[model samples]
Each structure stands twice: as structure tokens, then as C-alpha cells.
Target: MIVGMNMENQVLIVEDEDSLSSYLKTELTFENYDVLVAGDGEEAMTEFTEHQDTLGVVLLDWMIPKLNGLEVLRRIRKQTATLPVIFMTARDYVGDKVAGLDNGADDYITKPFEIEELLARLRVIFRHEAQQLQVAPVYEIANLKLDTKSHQVTRDDSHVQLTQREYTLLLYLLQHKEETVTRDELLDNVWGVDFVGQTNIVDVYIRYLRNKVDRDHTPELIHTIRGVGYTLREEE
Candidate 1:
């Protein structure tokens, strides 16, 4: 879907309204997501069954040509044990939203929703799923082992203790190893866009990462590129 992104995640949109389904498909595709459109509840179920492994989330409409939203949600919940499903309906009534969530929908987004809001919700769902999708994140370079899932790091059989901010910062740097990562990019992505602070946060975290992961090492792992940003790599 998105260039350079893993297509292991898929989203299904079930809406009988051809116009609405097409619009969603286009918008999601532009965001680099693998999206499938199902015209009705039955079709949605079929797609879900076929792509269960890769189906990360679903957007189900309230009324469809073949089966109604509630019935579809019931069938999906019975079939999909831990799959995330979001209800999309024109009915903005509080009762309808409550009913949908009570019946197992992960979230209920009313129709005429803001595109940005929908994207934000999808991001949250995907991130939550990703955390559960991986058992561990063990990244290694040379004699060092970084266990992001466990928040632990070890070098040459010796345990390296790091603060929460340091661990998170190192993991982020390691994930994008060898790339020049900007301070603003780090602030926005790591702490979230709404982080009520300045880019100095990145500097503070970088210092922490340096102390824990690089101080005793021979060749520096984290390199500061003047006028640009930082890079984490094995290269000198």
C-alpha cells in the first residue's frame, strides 16, 4: 500500500453505498493502505474470512443491501476473535453509537466524519494492534543486543540499564538506523504531534541514549550531523 510499508496489514470497508465505498477506498489507498471494499455484510464476511490473517481493521456501515449492520457485527464478532472493527453509520444518535460499541465494535464513527479524524482513529487502532502483533523486538548490531519489547539492552553479555526515555529514544533511532533523522521528526513521531514542548526534548533524549548505549563503545554509534540531524549506524 504505502511505499516502503509492509502490506501485512489490510483494512476492509463494508458499505453498500457504491459512492461512499469508492470514496473510502480512494482515500485509504492514498494513505498507503491495503483496503478492500465489500458491498454488503455477507460480502464483508467473505472477505474477512479470506484475508483474516492480514485484515487489520474493518469499517462497517449501519445499513447494507444484504444484511444490516448489527447482524453483520454479531456475525463478525462470532467469527473474528480479536479483530478490530469500527462502525460507520449515518445515524448519529447516541443510542446507535452506544449500541454498536456495546455489541463489540472497537469504535463508532458517524457519517460525514472528518477525514483527518478518521485517519487518526485508524492510526491508533493500527498502533495498538502492532504492539500485540510482535512478541519481541530484538535488534542486534555487532556485540550489542537491543530488546525493545522488553525495554532491555545488553552488550557483550553485560546488561545495560537505561531510563524509559533513553530506551524509547534508542529504539527509535535503531529502527531507522543509518538514516539522518531530524529533531523535529523525532519530537513529532515519538512524543506525538501534540507534544506541548520544543525540539530540545530530542537533544535531552539523545544525550540519554548516548550515555546508556554508546559511552563505553569504541566507535560512536550515534552520529550528529551538523546543520542536518542525527544518524545511528555502525559506520564511522
Candidate 2:
């Protein structure tokens, strides 16, 4: 059992299949996670709303009843854009996986997965979230400041709005300022080591951060390392 498990570390399982849902609940509970089960999209949303503050992550089945997984994720994103969501689907198609990620899933696992792997993935997500919480409330570099407690970023006197993923990515870069951080490193630290998707996700989010943090700003703090990776440092 997990030591010191609490409501704040709870996980929500949204799966319509009776056998699978029960198995997940039992396994998660065995691991000492406060588990909440919902058998359909509607129920999932209801449970999410009721326990949003307590939920640490969501394990959502792709083909759930009433609203489908993507729709449920869409609604969830509207409410809390940063809430971690993992899509569980039997479909092995890359297109489906891409759609899920594009629609807001933080990760996706093909069905018939081993429970051990799932547990490991959950641990990674939880670890990353905990690390973020422990970060200093404010980080500043060359007039750019990030406030972890407020979830806000500003340059000079201008505020910059970012999606949760973007904010996390930028924070990671700032944490490793001046050092070239590889795509694999970013994937492992920011997206989790179990993440099984395109590495281009790093590039995509880098573009996003650059647009918001540096496009119109001076002394562009984010820099490409040319064939190596990327770095965040004041221009030389």
C-alpha cells in the first residue's frame, strides 16, 4: 500500500466495462490510491466535477458510453486544462493516438496492458506533479519571471498566458537554464518516461513557448542548440 496516500493523491477511473473497471479499482485501491469509479462519460464528468480538487489523475477509457472519451476529455479541459489524463484504448492506430493527444490527453496506453506498467506510469505522473508542487514559487531569468504558485508568466511588465503543458515545458527549460536539454530528457521529465508517442511533441511545445515568451520580447531566453537540443539562457 502507498504510504501517506490521501484524497489529494486520488485517481479517477472512467471505464464502461464492468470487469475492467472493477479490476482497475481493485488494483488501484490495493496500491493505496483513493479510487473513484465511473461507468460512463456522464458519470465520469459528474465524478470529476465533484472531486476535481482531490483528483490527482484520470484514467479514461476511449470508447465509454454516452459521451466518448474524447468528448469527456474536451469537457474536462474546458474546466481544468492542466489535469493529467491518460487515455486507455484498444485501438492501436497512430492516428487515434494522435487525435487523443491533440484533444488534451496527457498520455495514452493501448489496451490489454500489464497492470504493472500502468502502475509505473501512474507513479511517474504522480512524481512529476509532486516535483512541480515543491518547486520555488518564482523563477526569474533575464526579466522573465514564472510564478509556480500563481501559474503565471511575465516578461518585463507584460503577462504571458500559457496552456498547462506549455507552462510545464517552459518551467522545465528554466529549471535547466543554460544547459542543453535533449528531446529524450524533456520527454522523460516532462511527459514521463513511459510516454510512448512522437518526440516532435517537444518541438511543438518549444515553438509554443517561443511564440508566447520570446516572439515579441527581447534577449530571447530560449535557444536552439543546433543538432544537440535546446537551451534556455540569456543571449551572449
Candidate 3:
């Protein structure tokens, strides 16, 4: 079981829009999340300070009153760097996305995005954090390591952050290390039978894993078998 998963199901929604905030609170509550709302930046900080320990995630709007979302996020980061914060903004510029990420947002969603997608992102953040807090085992290859106890990946002992999906995909590859595992096998095991629509997801995630786990490292561990699939093994 994921440690702290059940203990931290609360989320703070920092949006000034009444109708949208109310609607979101109702929706999230229905999905079993303890909902908290702060109409502006100051209130956002107050709510967060009070519930910092219990809070699992934060959904912050970019144009909130008093401090603005960016300022609020900065302040929150000072208090705690590990708390997950996702920016909800109307801005979709590449620069704006980079700024938010640089300012410590774990994710970003444009104003018109589907609620299901937002919920999905929240679930991913929760899963990742919960897994990080657990105590388990460690797997290693070359200079890379994955600690199941903390759900953290490290290269030469330096920490690497991964989303829940990416972590799961990596875990599966490690379990089948040194074997050329097929995409179909990966989808069946990693994405599961319910995964429909595309087969390229495995490829996409493999690329993601490479960028994080192998890019700058020597003796790259993840290898593609061309027409076959992929493998995780030490290459001499």
C-alpha cells in the first residue's frame, strides 16, 4: 500500500471565480477529495498554511487577486518544496509554460481543458507523492538506481523526478531487465488491457525514460531492439 495515500486526499483550489470554484469543489468532493477554496492569493496562503500537513495537492489559478498565482506559488515553494502545485491558467504560450514550471508548478492546464484530464493529472501527482513516501526495496543497473521504498529514480545518486506513469513504466522494464520486451507486452503489462487507441504510448514513454535515465549517463541501460521492442540491461 502507498504510505500517506489515504492520509493526504485534500486539495486547495485557488480560483476567484465563484461558479467555477463551486463547481470544482462539488466535482472533486464527489471523487473523494477533501476540497478547500481560496478566492484570492492571500486566502490561498492562509488556507495552505493551516492545512499544509494534510494537503496533498494544489490547483492554482494564474490571475488570482492580491498576490497572483505566480507569487502565491513562490511563497508556497519557500514554505515547502515538495508540495505538488498545478497551475490553471488561460495563458498557453510556451514561455508562460516554462515560467510556471520554473517557478515550481508540477503541471499546467489551460482554462478550457476537460475536467477529466485535470482529475487524471491530480491522480498522477497523488500517486507519485504517495509512492515517494513509502518504504520498500531498491533496484540498480550501472550507475542508475530506483528505490521502491521511496519510488525515486537516481542517476549516479542524483535524484530524478518522474510522473507516476513514467515510474510504473520504468519499474516494469527493470523487472524484465536484459530481456527484449515487446510493445504489446509492455502495453498489456504497463498500460494494461484497458489501454486503447494507440500503441505509440510505449514508445513515447520509453523516450521519456531515456531522456531522464540514460541521456547523460555512460553505458546507457535502455535499448531499443528495432523491430522487436525494448530492453533494460547493462551494456558493456
Candidate 4:
């Protein structure tokens, strides 16, 4: 039974041990956390990329097959600017801990950690994530404005209806205006790791956002970057 509600955010548990991963998954779920499990480093990367949008924290084992937790954490950090990652591994070397944090890990946990300690760390990460998201400024390009706080968008003073996914995509593009945000980046950052849908989903959503926000406007805000990806900026 759960000792308390998991007011902390969703977590992805990346551990190769079948028993430990399953136990963590069950415990976290019962405590009200949304959890995903990946047994290998490659799968962990895939899961983290796919679920990046909704994932608030990651519990990663430092040593694993395929990519290994350190490599996986590095890959995630390369794309995601400020993700909160906790290294839960037996590698307790000070050098290991420094390297992990230097490479983008938020915290480290040694093997045989108590569940309560894990929960406390998770709570800290979740609180930090919440604060960061709250402080991220709203982004705008052309006539489109996206208020990150409200997760709402408006085009030319008119409400442009968009699905939650659509809003996420739009906001991401707006954040990196003028530069092309790649399809793989979108797949990882917006749709997330658990999304098993077609890669073309990005294209479809782009079209939808364009039609709604730019179909009638004299200047378009979203531009298709041909083979690369999409860019959100003022039209030339």
C-alpha cells in the first residue's frame, strides 16, 4: 500500500534489473505517479525522448546494457536543455558523481537506497521542474502569441483553438524561433517516448497549426524547413 500520495510528477524508471524496475514501477504507480520503465539504455533514451514533454524526472541506473545510463543521460542532455535526471547506480566514485552531474544529471543515488530517500529526491526534482516551467517566459513570433503559463495561444487577437499536443509543438517551435527545430527533436520533446505513432504526426500537426494560425494572415508565422524540420518566426 502507498504511504502517501505522490504529489511529485511523472517519472521514468530506467533500470535493467527486472525485479527492481518492477518494484519501483509498482511503488511509484501506487503512490499516484505516472511511470514508464525501460530495461536498457537504448530503450531509456527512446523512452525519455518520446516522453520528454510529460516526464518530470528520470531514475536512471548508471550501468546497463545497450547505451548505459551515463550515455543515455548524455544523449538526453544534448537535446533537452534542463531535464532533471537522477543517477541511481552502484557507481559511487566521486569522479563518477562529478562526471554524471557535469554531463547533466541533477542528482545521484547509490545502490541499496531506501525508498523514502528516493521519494524525497523525486519530490525535490518535481518541485524544481515546476518552478522552472513556471518561470519560462511566454514566446511569440509574428501575430501568434503563446503564453507558457496558461499553455494557451492566440493569433491576431483571436483565439486559435489547438489541442494540447498542438500547443506543445507550437510552443517548442516558438522557443527556437528563426532556427529549424528538427523532426527528431519534436518527436523527442513534444510527442515523447511512449508515443508509438507515425513520425508524420509532426507534419500533420504543423499543417493544422499553420492553417489555424496563418491560413488567412498576410504573414505566416510557421515555416516548413523543407527536409530539415519547421521554423517558427516572422515571414519574410
Best by TM-score: 2
Model 4 CA deviation exceeding 4 Å by range: 1-8, 132-236
Q: In candidate 3, what are the lDDT values of residues 92-196, reduced to their tens digit?
A: 787886688666675678888778878877776666556545646687888888877655678998987665456777887887898889999987765555443
Q: State which candidate, 2 or 4, has the greater lDDT.
A: 2
- lDDT: worst 10-residue window of model 4: 1-10
The positional error of residue 169 in candidate 3, measured at the CA in angstroms, is 6.6
- Against the hidden reference, what TM-scores do the models get? 0.54, 0.86, 0.63, 0.54
Sorted on TM-score, highest at the top, how do the candidates line up? Answer: 2, 3, 1, 4
Q: lDDT winner among the candidates?
A: 2
Query: Considering lDDT, where higher is better, how would the candidates rank from best to worst?
Result: 2, 3, 4, 1
Give the distance in Å from residue 228's predicted Cα in candidate 3 to where it truly belongs: 9.3
lDDT of each residue in 109-134, candidate 4, tens digit only: 78887887777666655653455365
Question: Against the correct fold, how does model 2 do in TM-score?
Answer: 0.86
Q: What are the candidates' C-alpha RMSDs?
A: 12.1, 4.5, 5.4, 13.7
Worst 10 residues of 2 by lDDT: 1-10
Q: lDDT of each prediction vs. the true structure?
A: 0.72, 0.83, 0.79, 0.73
Clashing pairs in 3: 136-149
> What would the C-alpha RMSD of candidate 1 be, to one decimal place?
12.1
Give per-residue lDDT, candidate 2, residue 128: 67
Q: Which scores greater on lDDT, model 1 or model 3?
A: 3
Model 1, span 1-236: residue lDDT tens: 11111126688999998888898899999998899999987898889778876777889999887788888887876654346677889997867865875565656677788778778877865664466347566887766788655445787768775533355567678878889999887766555464443566577667766776778885678889887779888876
